[model samples]
Target: MKRLWGILCIMVCCTGELSAQKAAGFKGWFINNVKIANSMRTLDLSEQPAQLQLTFPRYQAHSYLVNMGIAVILNNNTTLNYISDLNVEYHRNTLTDAEQNNFSAGYGFKWRFANAGAADYFMAGDLQYLYNELNATNSLGGTFLLTLFRDGKRLNWNTNNFRLNNRLLFNLAPFAGFQMQEILKSRQNGMAGFILRPEFSINTSLAFCKKAGPPYDKLLAIFCNYTGRDDAINTTSFKEHYTQLLHTGINYYLAYSPFEVSIGASFNDGSDPLNGRTQQQYWQVSVNFLK
Candidate 1:
């Protein structure tokens, strides 16, 4: 009995030490989002002009999305470190009049070089590629964004393992950024033009569950994004421009061993004029696998 007890004590100590080491090393997560929605109304193809006649179905709108990316923790020395994130999202929207598909991928890196007792100084840049296919119309484009922030740090209450601890409390990342969009193709009255955009975004979250005591297990987040783009004509000089829509969404995440699932919904105003003014609402579900 004495020999057995001694072995058990040694094993417990070893496990504790290993856990501590893991907590101290570089931590990262890869996540994905997939979703589907249905439209609230259907267009009347039999009408004189084939106008869109709104009708409520069992489901309002459906959307599918897949976003997979990894974020790395550089260091934890002084709460100031470098972080990098690479993400890609694929979205498909089926509407009463048309079906739209978009693929977007971007990589971003941020540096937290200084924390002036109350605020953190950070700078980030991201480059994204977008491919959009609208029914018979096809458009290819890309965007480059740059942001600078002096955000105050607070405790993040959300418990999701995919998110960092300081994500929920009272942190504010008030940032200003610029985005440039370049269109590559135009067919079926597609808009192929360049736009200079200014954007602002906010991220907030709530903690729901705890897993390993220190790290949370589940989280809920509210994020808002707004972009304003200036019109730039194409080679054909077709005056095609509209104010970009504002987007707001809520997200929830449940973290498991090597995988996690996220669910979210987003609302956006009309950006393009199909027949008249049109608005879009999207609901999404995503599953992520980490290596």
Candidate 2:
């Protein structure tokens, strides 16, 4: 009996130590934002369009994206955060055996200022870069048969098809949100349960350079809040080179002690009609390491 009790105590101690380590240093989520069909509503698995019956060669575009974030506690009331995104995209044409590939990357930093409370406040800034290359042959019985359209531009040649959008966009955002913990308790394990968190932020983007035409460059709107317009010249709400927007999100999680599996939805109230995205939203399934 004594030996059994000693072993049980050791196991408990080990478990407690592991839990503490997870809580102290780890804070992030593995979020897949572009796994399925591109839609604003649900998390659908199929790549097919709303009309699922007919699949065409021109509609063969796939994007894979991952978003990650880590937070470090600086003090009792301050935390610093780093976030990143990686994306790979491919488009294929069966008729002409043409292909277009794209890669995108984003990095951001955030500062959270809050007391020990259920709700927290933060400010964040981010940047994004994109690159695209197209590969096609000019052989169609001495006549080029391959044609591609991108960003309102038409393409007919195999060369000069690569584009590098190293625009270096910057977004500054301020956010406020709350997390409701212990919404549901587990029956068997005391440390397992459910949690709900909803957050919103206002944001503005600045691009030092200009695009070739209309539809300004914008990225990482989901991390921003209620910044005003970017039109006027000399006002607090006036952003010089870009636009202002609002971003909001809600997350529902199933917690198992230091880990959580969650489903989240986010939206951006975009106002730039020329930028192509008047409004944008998405749903994501994620595994949160710590929060």
Candidate 3:
């Protein structure tokens, strides 16, 4: 970790210089944020969910990116499962002269879950191809995720593994590692960079409903992760500094059919120190829709 800090320190000191060499855009946000907290288990495999289906995100053309993609989970059973997705994206230039269209595909398998410990686990690999109008670039990447706890909402895959009774108060365990993360990125004009920073989030599902239901619904969450792996822990004080966002929102499930649709919106407080030594604070709106 010491060596990691040393490299991150150099990057911080030369953040401005580094951007001059490459297009920072929103990518700079990743390097600016770094909070390293230890985590426990990982996995969230609930058989109660839709066994298999096609999934897609809200298509927002107004985004810095106007893109679309679809994903499929071949299985939700204990026997064997495989998944895949294909996405095409267009990145608009927020600064400098950078505009590109990208296409990427990824595949991965799910593990057979056991109730004993961390059960929701998945690992996947990807291949991305990018075209900047001038040149083409290709890169390879993968993701590894594990759920840290057994959600009180679902039965453990192996019921014998968990012998706990559920109560209303036992619901909220603050700072527990129930976060889901994915680091998605690709090379730019043949240059490698963070497409999406590694992110961690925590939230509850308490909502005002017309009928009695699970204690938690309408996905409530707050996530923090670096804008990039460009920096690591240098000083312990650095732990307290970095770019991160807090989101208060609701996820409304629209369907349980072959296709699932969900829409969510959040009031976001985006924080960063790149403007200077002090973190600049601002408020923005985040709306997400996935089908």
Q: Which candidate is the best by lDDT?
A: 1
lDDT tens per residue, model 3, 119-145: 444333333333332234444434344
Candidates in order, TM-scores: namely 0.50, 0.26, 0.39
TM-score order of candidates, top first: 1, 3, 2
Error of 2 at 241 (Å): 4.9
Mark the regions of model 2 whose C-alpha exceeds 4 Å error after superposition. 1-59, 71-242, 271-291
Model 2 C-alpha lDDT versus the unseen true structure: 0.28
Given candidate 1, what's the lDDT at residue 146?
Answer: 38
RMSD versus native structure for model 2 = 24.9
Between the candidate structures 1 and 2, which one is better when assessed by lDDT? 1
lDDT tens digits, residues 63-119, model 1?
222222222222346544665444443334444334445444454556656655644
The true-structure Cα RMSD of candidate 1 reads 15.7
List of clashing residue pairs for candidate 2: 201-224, 201-225, 202-224, 202-225, 202-226, 203-225, 215-274
Per-candidate clashes come to 27, 7, 20
Clashes of 1: 27
Could you tell which candidate, 1 or 3, scores higher by lDDT? 1
